[model samples]
Target: MNRCLISAAMAVFFFFLAWAVSLRQALLFLVGIGLGGVLAGARFGFTTGWRLLIENRDASGVMAQLFLLGLAAAVCMPLLAAFPGELGAALGPPSYSLLIGAFVFGLAMQVADGCGSGTLYKAGLGIPLNMGILPIFALGSFLGSAQLEQWLQLGSIAPVGLVARFGLLEAFGITLLGLIALGWAALRWSDRIAPWFNKKLFIGAMLLAVLAALNLIIAGQPWGIVYGFGLWGAKAATALGVFDPTANAFWSEPVNVRTLSQSVFLDVTSITNIGILAGALWIAAKRKVGAAEPRSLTGTQWVVGIAAGFLLGYSSRLAFGCNIGAMVSGISTGSLHGWIWVPMAFMGSLIGVRVRRRFNF
Candidate 1:
């Protein structure tokens, strides 16, 4: 896979999307490629970032994340406000499901060693553990979505949109302030001598923020990861005659039903996800020889890691999104559930990191 071959293949795929799907989907695929490239090239690992913060008191990764959040909010909030009719935000209810889901997702991600996007990019990079976990993650996501209505029935509240409730300026201000406060807290908790910034990470955050804004603009929705995984699982189950979309509350919706019948390339998230994979593959192909070999795991470690991947998928649906869907898109778009998702997931990560350590992962 030379760069020329990768570029040609991507171009051919883009033409297929434009011809068979729509130009918008084609462009989104490109955006997804950019996302994959940046994520893999920059080594942007949300799960690893949190783990580093917890285990090493390192703030560099966390701070880079905060920068990403803030930058994305700066761009996305305004677009959401201006195009309220055309664009939609990532909004999820504040529910018992969220509390439980986010916590478990955080914990599971730590053990699995990847969140939604992290898993995707790493899988694209041909990491054996993540590649193995991908299907299990999809299965868990489908199961979680199938049972989501029941989870909400336990207890939930209406989703709150800061932009809608507080107006654009106020919502944006609050988002930035919250990020700044988090950055301060991360700094305080970090090792005194630990570096606060890395040039590569900063550039990565900037590029990702811009790319996320592009996704929102082109797709008429914020960037997401897990929904696509769940959808893939649902499609597989339906093909196997093991699942009924009409019976499941989440999958029974008009839109969901329509999406199920259509080609996955027509689905916004799926196309982007595919693009991310392609982009990552491109990066992997171009890498120099002698890249570090993946670590080998014991049988028990393999079981735990794979099982954790399942939990990651299931919990992401319950949580309304993973780090990308919930935290980045949620907070950037002014959804309060995103705000609620953070601390709960962080608490889960606190426990997850310990479990990871216990297993010596």
Candidate 2:
């Protein structure tokens, strides 16, 4: 009963907020709420899912992600081509910043135990540590964004879109084949069938792909996570008079300037972010939510987790995304940067696991 009331209140609050902004904003918020529910109820998580494969060589979670990526790509790339500027892909410059940023993000997530979307939902579920991690993550995001322009100047290339370069047909085929190969690699490595597939989880991933596609269709761009967090932190800092957006290169960009001045709810990523957290909370209050088992950690572990959360935000800005935004949406949009992000992040994951073990974490 209490859960229902809380959910109702959140819904009302977001509705009014979104409505006050625009109907489109409201719709995006609704999609975000749906995303949160899907994430919580099905327990769809990119961070722990990747960790499972990394630590145990369990490929089930990775396989589902691949499927989701492939399906999203099939639907999204063509739409981007047809609509051109109206429908944007999650493209990023191929730069040293992306390489280093993604690698560090991977390591941080392993220690922090959540990626962008994962952290949002977990925090929404009221996990005490995750809740604590949220603000620190926001702070790191603000700092990272503040310096991002300087990093890009070091060495960067224009953003590439596979559909634009290869055409929709070719891009789709290549993307599908790549996903199939990735899925097969995951399958072959597992050496068993029993754990290879779960009908419910597989279906859940497929549905997730659909929702992701819907996000692109409605918002005219792919779903993003870290950008919203960064925006929030920037806004808070500005409000506190600790920072001046007018001087920050990244914030001073024409598009960003407008977004910062406007209500946060008008921001596509922010609206969805709010929905995911609220939806996750509603689900946790109603039924068993999807999450790994909890365990007690040492004081060292807690400190590491908190620090890692900060890194997760900072590194994600440098890297262009977390697991969902980079590995998932990045690949789905057929950006070469997405491909680059994965292998580097995976390498970080390997190192992260060993470091974690030393702490017995």
Candidate 3:
């Protein structure tokens, strides 16, 4: 079948999948698909307009990411303002823990080669090791979450809302225009800067805007991906009875426990992760990205990567977002955590690079 037909068929299939699932979950799943698809496209060297962000090689991915985040934040502002108490409540009050957790999680992303969403997408695309890493990372999240449940109990500073300040359309429209212009400028600047930037800047920025908006429309919540790791992790642990029931003493309420648990089965992110892998595999098969195969890595390397993934996943949950969740979605909402996580993760990536080199597996 033609690529366009295949793409259209995939869209239709997802539409039906969305229809069969809750709208919220459907939207999140689609968001995951979009994210994975874009990354995969970039990997393939297909600089399709507004879809190129393969390696984040240039400022292309960065600009697009900023736009996407800006759009979401703009939309969320009004929603929060209208329901001040509710908005203030879901995001919770910010705390110092977010800072600490975000930094560590950021580092984890570097080690893992991708954040939660990116990891899933890469695995989907037939990255031999990432496929193995997915469940192991999930396992790490579970173990780490069990260990860090206490810190999560603490809350953070409340986020400011737009609903309190402006109407939905007014907020979204203003934000959209500003974000688009900013993205456009960033793209133009990148094009003049270097080779990498020129090819991907505008497309990356536009996709960022599109993904963020699509996430808002579908998820009813802003885009996020960290919780999926923790949820899956927690569930896996719970199934194994690895956690002590009293370990949850840090929780302000039982609802947190339930939410954490529900993430395993109910989180749209998790479902999307599964779908992204499936979609990527489908595409990879046709494109000859290479068939999935188990690679021969040493036992020690596996343990280190898995351990690093666990640290990242657990830390991401504590911070309340992963790369996608915090960096993408949180930033889109203009939350402090997003900003905090990005730099921290970059530093962590440094550690990841070192570890990869040291192990040399």
Model 2 residue 173 lDDT?
A: 88
Whole-structure CA lDDT of model 1:
0.95
Deviation from truth (RMSD, Å), model 2: 2.2
Cα lDDT tens digits for candidate 1, 1-361: 5878988999999999999889999999999999999999999999999999998999999999999999999999999999999999999999999999999999999999999999999999989989999999999999999999999999999999999999999999999999989999998988969898988999999999999999999999999999999999999999999999999999999999999999998899998899988889899898888878888989999999999999999999999999999999999999999999999999999999999999999
Q: Tell me the lDDT of model 3 at 241.
A: 78
lDDT of 3 by residue, 85-179 (tens): 44431242255667677667655555556667667767776675676678777776655556554565564556543333455666555556656
TM-score of each: 0.98, 0.94, 0.71
Poorly placed runs, candidate 3 (over 4 Å): 1-24, 44-60, 71-93, 147-149, 152-193, 196-198, 244-265, 289-300
Per-prediction count of colliding residue pairs? 0, 0, 24
Error of model 3, residue 118, in angstroms: 1.6
* TM-score computed on alpha carbons, candidate 1: 0.98
lDDT of 3 at 252: 24
Per-residue lDDT of model 2, residues 1-361, tens digit only:
3697977888787679755778787777778888888888778877666777777778888887887898888888888888997988898888988999999888888877778888889888777778878888988988999999889988999977788899999888888888888777777766464486656668878888888888998898899999999999999999999999999999999999999999887889998898888888888787445655567778998898899899989989998888878877888988888988988888888887776677776
